[model samples]
Target chain A: MEDRFEISLLLDFYGNLLTPKQKTIMELYYNEDLSLGEIAEINDTSRQAIHDLTKRCYKLLLNYEEKLSLLSKYNIREEKYKIALEDIKDRFKLSDEAINYINKLFEDINNS
Target chain B: MEDRFEISLLLDFYGNLLTPKQKTIMELYYNEDLSLGEIAEINDTSRQAIHDLTKRCYKLLLNYEEKLSLLSKYNIREEKYKIALEDIKDRFKLSDEAINYINKLFEDINNS
Candidate 1:
């Protein structure tokens, strides 16, 4: 996967692990399309505090992603699976015998 | 945005909103690079339960994304901000006066 996609996935996963306040602020700012000032007013926090929290949360998320690489590994495995599936489909189209063999093979694989 | 990118973002966001057990299964299967049997062994759950939970979580996440579109909206906004930043950077090298004006403008924008 591309670095940007990896970063986005990491951020999404890390964001879920944050505290409710942090999650709410992130959701309001990034997901809810709220301005900093608007979020500060609604949450009854100072604008500077909100900004600081947002910055800190972003840094934390990036750090977690760098250390764990969870999302990157997941993407790689997923890509591998997709390629395997496509290859099987291609083989299936080449011969009816291949199709039945592949189907049975997949069932066996799943059962095992 | 491309459909694949949108779908991936939606899945990531929706995954965040899932129950801890569902999230744990997803992380194990997708992020931890574990097989269903391996995950079942580690979680001390039946293989069928793990399989069922994983399938259910995937469908639930997709449905939530379809209903909310939170991640898609966030991605669009992020793209707009990135484009704006790039445009400002491009303008910066064209003229020193423009550079200073844009820098000041950005400061004002941030301050506001």
Candidate 2:
């Protein structure tokens, strides 16, 4: 729950790997921030079942992250881009417009 | 079989997600280019079992790739870097040494 944003990010990377049910439940609980009882009621399942499904989804997401490290790789790539941009700015003495454009591009990438 | 290199690259991204047995089979078949019969004999399994395991591994790897698209993302990133490098080279007029260093870095990334 504390790492809800991180979990959502992981879901972005590996959500398609999940079953439809798992993906739906994840969207309900994490994206919609639904209570277990609310989700269970909506899905016509017991609260306990909803809880269990959520736990399984968490475990599965963690497992995928652990194995693939796509999230980590992404963070690393972002960091590298930042460093490269800085290097270019310093070494090449890029113009303000050029730096601004580069910053905008990086912002678009990070948003995406 | 035809996309052996592609399969190997997929395995690189998601190999650790597989069961140890699956990883071993993939390493034997893809990395070592071992025959199915040879792998079966060494692993004390039938050729059919080896064949089935490999097929499952392929399916699982493909599933991961389809879901995560990390391989595709990596390709896109590399392409972006190439374009960015070219843009910088043309606009900033970086030194030949800088261009060579950047090319070497990209080569390292591609090899990795």
Candidate 3:
């Protein structure tokens, strides 16, 4: 998919929300870049099973995003932080500590 | 439980991520404030089943929070917005147009 990387990022945030089987298949297919046949062989399941599980996992992740919008909110928050940081820097020459504190906030937002 | 309200908020965000049964039970129990017996009677399931489903739903919501932390990030963002708003107001002596624009940003943060 064109948004495989984006989905991978969403998986990072909400992958644990899936069942163990779903999570394992997703890790194999997306992270490990395994083909359906390869995953089925590794897990001793039919390729169809792997395909269904992967589809279900993707749907579930999309559902989570639709309901929560966590990924979108994170991006918006990061953008706003950058804009505000720039505004602060431009309007008032902030102290080193102040800059460090804002930087820390940005890091915390990303890490969280 | 002590975090019933908090879980309800989490449910608002991630509840759609649950199964249909899980979502229904959670809605009846948490949002509608139904007892186990009431839910069981309405759903035509045993009280024990209702209780178990409720527990499972709680765990799922908690797991989602543990992984994604959307609510926590939201609170932190709101706090930072307030802090930054105050800082801008204090340091910049901004025009009314600027103040209104900042207020609009605050509203957007809260809504999103």
Candidate 4:
């Protein structure tokens, strides 16, 4: 299963693990879609600091992900569960047994 | 705000960005707290795949975080906002100005 969430979600999950400075730079660049020069001007920091911070923050996020793999798993499960639920809901001809099974499956998912 | 959420949260958010095999290995190792050998046994994959998967997943997560940063910001803002709301609610002697200010703050937070 080559399941992968969007890059934006990944950024949202790991950005806080960075330093405040790094976080700011990342937000400015990624979320705000600001240029490096614009971020530098806004923070009154050098463009170099912004660049270095972005690089270091990226490295930190990678390191953290390596040690812990929860974000990725959560994303995959959430997507799968959502799609499953939607598909079940969309099926108009689901029998009572199918409905019961789907309910049980959802319960198991919630419990997990 | 260096308001980082738990590592588990980060893992949950970023884990889905990996392959299904990688995501499974991660869930077994991190969420299930299983040993590498155990994960290997369960998945019928090599211990080396488990190790390498973990390593690569981590790197992918980090790279994703570097490029985008919503998770980090969301966590910090959520923490700060929760604390602020709790504190305001707990304060028994808040003036009308304070109440109005807090209400406005919460409104802004929700809108954001």
Candidate 5:
């Protein structure tokens, strides 16, 4: 529950890799911020079962992140774009419009 | 198969999402250019089984690509960077070093 934010981000990168049951539990638990009892009620399962699945789903997301590091790769790409933008700004009279467009390009990158 | 090239490219994006056995079969069948009989011999599975798995693996990759579209996102990012670089070149007296660094940033993006 405390790590909901991290799990939500991981869900974006690896959620499709999860089983349908696992994906639903994760969306309910992390994205929707539902309580275990609430998720269990919706899924017609026991609170304890929901708790275990939430835990297992969290672990599965972590395991995929560890193996693939897609999230880290994404962050690194963001960082590189940020630094390149800064470097361009520092190195020249790069126009504000140009910089803004570059920012927009990165926004496009993320929207994908 | 003629699709060996396409599968190899997809492998870079969705390889980790595959099961261990599927991953091996794909690497062998596509990357190593192994025939179905060869893959079957290596895995000690029947040719029919290997054939079925390879077809299923390719379809699985296509399904993931369709759902996630990570590879398409990647191509769009590359295209965006290329356009941004060109726009900067056209808009300003941006240094060669700066442009080179921008290209380098994209290379890093792909390496990730």
Candidate 6:
């Protein structure tokens, strides 16, 4: 089965908005690595129905992500964290003042 | 009038969710620096009503912010941007590889 990583990320972010049935179908299809035929049989439905529902669920999740952009914002934050951590860890041995300045910058951000 | 910067930021973020009249009142009170009396007279309402309504709108916006957290996420993103720019510009005399790496990190974030 193909690895549907993007949809998995979207699911993690917006899965709560999906109906339980739709969400289950998605989890089975993407997360559980179940074939659509197996999922349909488990749900006592046709393979075609599972296929369509999964597609619709994917679109719905995408729509939610597009409007709110919570996923994109989250990814950006992660990137920033990774970059800052790597930079401070690997390079730029600095004085106590510079270290404190960096620490204070993040402290103020967290407080805000 | 004492500066109410926080409400102004909240209004910018969650203002669209508010009722039209509520939005107008908030904008007038915070953006236009109008007194409650001035706003009440303009709307042909009691000053006390305007005062209470503005207070209510403030709480409503706060609730929206608390639940969605769009504002806090935005602040964190801004802090990251400011730090990255300051890091690249004010401090780090970087090699081409380091500059390219940082640029790629942000570009990937923007693309995502």
Q: What C-alpha lDDT do the candidate models reach, one value each?
A: 0.59, 0.79, 0.77, 0.60, 0.81, 0.73
**Candidate closest to the true structure, highest lDDT:** 5
Interface RMSD of each: 21.2, 3.5, 4.4, 15.7, 2.4, 7.0
After superposing candidate 4, which stretches have Cα over 4 Å from the reference? Answer: A1-112, B1-7, B86-112
**Tens digits of lDDT, candidate 1, A1-112:** 2243443455566665577788788777766668999999998989999989878877777765565444554455345434544554463333545335434433332222
Q: Which residues of candidate 1, in runs, are more than 4 Å off?
A: A1-8, A94-112, B1-112
Comparison by lDDT, 4 against 6, better one: 6
**RMSD, every candidate, angstroms:** 21.3, 2.8, 6.0, 16.2, 3.0, 9.3
| lDDT by residue for model 1 (B1-112), tens | 2244443444566655677777877777776668999999988989999989877777776665554444554455345434544554463333545335434433332222
Q: Residue A85: error of model 4 in Å?
A: 30
Q: Over the stretch B35-105, how does candidate 5's per-residue lDDT look in tens digits? A: 99988898888999999888888998888788777778788878877887788677766778878876786
Off by over 4 Å in 3: A15-68, A72-112, B95-101
Model 2, A18-76: lDDT tens per residue? 89889989988888899999999999989999989888888988988888776886687
Range of the 10 consecutive residues with the lowest summed lDDT in candidate 3 chain B:
B103-112
Docking class of 4: incorrect
> What CAPRI-style quality would you assign to candidate 2?
acceptable
- DockQ agreement of candidate 4 with the native complex: 0.03
Candidate 1's docking class is incorrect
Stretches > 4 Å off in candidate 6? A1-3, A89-112, B1-112
lDDT of 4 by residue, B38-86 (tens): 9889888889988887777767766666654445645555555555445
B1, model 1: CA deviation in Å? 50
- Residues B1-112 of candidate 6: C-alpha lDDT, one tens digit per residue: 4247988988987786677889999999999999999999999999999999988998887886776666676667566755664575466465666556555554454333
Candidate 6 lDDT by residue in tens digits, A10-108: 887677667778888899888899999999999998999999999899988888777666677666656674566457546645455555555555444
lDDT of 3 by residue, A29-66 (tens): 88889999999999999999998888888888898788
- Candidate 3 to truth, TM: 0.60
Measured by DockQ, the strongest candidate is 5
